[model samples]
Target chain A: MTADMTTDMIADPSGTRSPGEVLSWSRATLEPALRGAVDTLPGSLRHLVGYHFGWWDERGGPTGSAAGSGKAIRPALVFLASRAVGGDPLAAMPAAVAVELVHNFSLVHDDVMDGDHTRRHRRTVWSVFGVGPAILAGDALVTLAMDVLDGHPATSVLAAAVQDLLSGQSADLEFEDRNDVVLPECVRMAQQKTGALLGCSCAIGASFAGAEPVRVEHLRGFGEQLGLAFQVVDDLLGIWGDPAVTGKPVFSDLENRKKSLPVVAALTSGTPAGELLAERYATADEDLPGLAALIDEAGGRAWAHQQADALVEAALCDLRLADPAPGPAAELTGIADLVTHRDS
Target chain B: MTADMTTDMIADPSGTRSPGEVLSWSRATLEPALRGAVDTLPGSLRHLVGYHFGWWDERGGPTGSAAGSGKAIRPALVFLASRAVGGDPLAAMPAAVAVELVHNFSLVHDDVMDGDHTRRHRRTVWSVFGVGPAILAGDALVTLAMDVLDGHPATSVLAAAVQDLLSGQSADLEFEDRNDVVLPECVRMAQQKTGALLGCSCAIGASFAGAEPVRVEHLRGFGEQLGLAFQVVDDLLGIWGDPAVTGKPVFSDLENRKKSLPVVAALTSGTPAGELLAERYATADEDLPGLAALIDEAGGRAWAHQQADALVEAALCDLRLADPAPGPAAELTGIADLVTHRDS
Candidate 1:
């Protein structure tokens, strides 16, 4: 494990550990737990799931098998929430598995719908296997995830989680068509697209702990706020983070013409940046580069960063309301801050 | 509704009801159930689902009413099986809704994959709404079905049902690429594609009734057998049924060069009839008329009819093992006979 993967930090700004240390530790603990679940899929489907999980090469062979797997941040948050409520993180394992699977399933399908050839520096599932097989694989994984929830969690909790995932996905799809999405709408979209799953994850963990309904609600709120903050940070990174650190090409969102939180915030600015970005989105694909420059000149980047900062502050407020016990909660809050504040 | 929609005995002799009647009843029950659930979707997604469900016209406006909704036979089986097993069918309503939604979700995606333009004499969801929106609608419905399952059934039962749906879908997709599918393999594929969901429906009903595991297994077996019989009848209709009765043009299997049961059986035939049929299957798309004649000469229709008859007998044998007490069980038996023996 990396030396960076075993440190702790307090929630307060005055906390001592570096952000990288907390992030690394969260990654260290979450990867194996999520990977173990992925490895447990039936033989017929395991190879496809593994390919999506970044553990297998195209021909059902093993990839390098190193642990640059997905960030695992979502699963970490789930486990952390469970522990914060004095529940065993192990008890929340199935939920962690479910949420991660749903996330990956969406990724596989979204890549197809967007016609994105590459994901995580490898050929997307649809690109390598053809659209039909890729679609089947994604559908299978999603079904399997719901099935896993059958094992230990309460049916109500699992149902709620699945509902949240669907609602979020529905909102995300809706956002694609609108020409004028505002900050509040984007925030709501982020909640549905990102917050719903996170909230469900936390709620599931609390259920396993046998926490009271009020407590579960509190944890859900904390998760929702955290997710919103995470998405806002993601939007900022889409526009401004260095390619090497973010592992995405420069101007990637601009090229896709994604109306992310920052772009939406800038559009709310009702200034040149918002107008330029909207004009670029309406323009033909061939003219994107010049339009992207106009957007940058209009302060889209700075406005997006400001939005991220505000969301992170709001998330901290929700975390305070949860009033979790000191150790795990502090560590989780620190990690949330790291996620909301980081460049990558 | 047309008189044809109410009753047409010779056209559906083995079936308990005519296609028009069966289709209409299914529409009546499922439309209200589905509308209740879809009402929860956001404006954009709600509209998309509405259009796909045949509640809207080509221009995205409401059609003033729903028409041509799919036959909700799967949901009926779930409810019928529940009642047959002495369970309160009302308790299984959520699951009944779930199975039907999943079935429709598959139908939407399958139509796209198969490049089918019309279903029930109406343009397909993809044909009207564009592929992107249709895909989102399918994904939304699938997730919603999973959510619906969360409400009423036990977690384990719902999970298992979801897994069965996915497994069945996987096998069906696998069948598309397989040209060497034999009779037993076809039976197995049918079991996976159709039998599994039927089995789940039965098992879920048993769960509601607090039935013994052994009894549940028997009911599941009955459902599985019935499902296979149902598919075999469908295969027969694909090749030789009357257009007015089936709603599809005759000899569609020949036009699509589909590997239906009769085609598989004839391929096994070493007689002149078999040779002629094989030659027809090998012919180009432009040779459909001659191919249909060749298939008829090969006794493919008779062979398929015989196979379907045998499957129906087997299904009845399995049902007897369940020993379902009078009313609902008898009605279910009657329905099975209709599915297997119906002309359309």
Candidate 2:
């Protein structure tokens, strides 16, 4: 399609490309293959799928949808891990495409289950096309992922990750009805919901490279820790990041009453702010700056930052063990740091 | 696993068994593997999956649940087609289990989509577990199916069938809200919704037997035709069969305003009855006996029966090119007849 889609992360054989370039290159390289896999559906369904990808509008004409095709981080893991393990990154296209497909599948279904009408600053699949088609489309994407990555290890790994994802989602839904969700349980949910696929993404890339079982496990751990760190940083951003960059009101998680890790931490802090926030949470009114101050007062923000840093350190440790190359290893570590340290 | 789950359809290799006995035997043989695969899920989710399989109740006990394990027809196709092609049906266990899982996945999602509260005389997965858990469970089953049956041909075929099934369902949902549905479109939709999975089941079995491409094609054609014929018979029974046998009120398709094949055909028949039926459909309060008389008077019942029989004959012709053994061939024909000719 485009020259942009032709550049691979491996173009930097001199070991000098920045991690941002690596992520962008991997996204560009994987774009055509992802589109090709999705375009195999029959006409009408293909249009609906394209709409979800933000490549086309409801009328199937390309224009003006603001839905960014995600950050491509998981797919980056796939390609980089494959190349790091001495395999051709291009040879791992199927694995890369599979993870991206599964990631989008989860996005569509989660939007429906959460009843959220908007994502990526655009209407969701269910909001646009209705629940029936949205559900079917989600199912189609998952099946197509398997269709592309057909065979052992990949299929089992993807399926097991999906299992964990669903388990995490199940717990998340149940948590909505209870006020007793602990930090560890919430962390486990995040690991399964967000971390499992990321971990599997790296494992799949390693498997593509014919890496040994232990090596694959290490790469998976690397990605798993990265995934958990991403969630923690995300939680911190939700609560404390600038409204201009984060695109939300300050301390919005407090108003939204989401059972985020910081909320769990603050509730378990046993401080007067914890009791006041809990009271406000039950009453649907928060003391704004006071609630924000209380979360910080209870060490929630600082704790999340520490956890995120620890996770990134753990992730880098595994990455060093699994990938001895200076270039790809540096790129992976850089991307991890960028995500953790990003204001938005 | 019990002795029941251990009995293969080929256990009666002596060729004395009726087709019904063959189906029952195959299902029994596949039961252990089926249970083993489902039991792979984590504890709570496993219980939910088990309940959907009619293996347990909401309380996770084994008794007092009126649910029947499904007819296992698609799975029987996998096992029987394998044996008919001179292979051990037992070796196709993975394929058989995969098909069943996909079928149940569709069932769970479909029940939620259509808002049908009960199936096979039991509450649906969603009705018991809520929509989110049910949706997750359905997704889990599909991923699990692909996981177990990973690899070329099988994975691609299953994935494609899943796509077709979703397309058919999308069309079916749209058809419900439209008034211009024609007979051919309805038939095509039925082929996708019901026929695709069946065709894939046979194809998977053939591939498991390492059959050549042409042989696989013929077996798939046979299964596809069989699936189409099944819809025609089911439509006929829904409209005109005896209430006691069909398990519905007399001529209930009219009462429900469902656009079944016969209704679609008769609405386009151009007879006085067709005009009257069309008008009555718009009004939504038709005289039951009069609507029934009109449909039959317009030759709707006869037409469906003819279509069913012709489709079976077409299916049989393909079977003739497939298994040349008199015994297994005759058994397949018998099963086809049993499905097509039954009132319910």
lDDT of each: 0.67, 0.81
Identify the leading candidate in terms of lDDT: 2
DockQ of 1: 0.32
Each prediction's TM-score against the native?
A: 0.86, 0.92
In model 2, the clashing pairs are A151-B151
lDDT of 2 by residue, A13-75 (tens): 556456677777877788899999999986657777778888888778886643457678889
Worst 10 residues of 1 chain A by lDDT: A4-13
Worst 10 residues of 2 chain A by lDDT: A1-10
Candidate 2, after superposition: displacement of residue B8 in Å? 6.0
**Where is model 1 more than 4 Å wrong at Cα?**
A1-44, A66-68, A151-178, A240-250, A285-289, A342-344, B1-32, B56-66, B151-158, B175-179, B241-258, B266-284, B294-300
Predicted structure with the largest DockQ when compared to the true one: 2
Model 1 chain A TM-score equals 0.85
Error of 2 at A103 (Å): 0.1
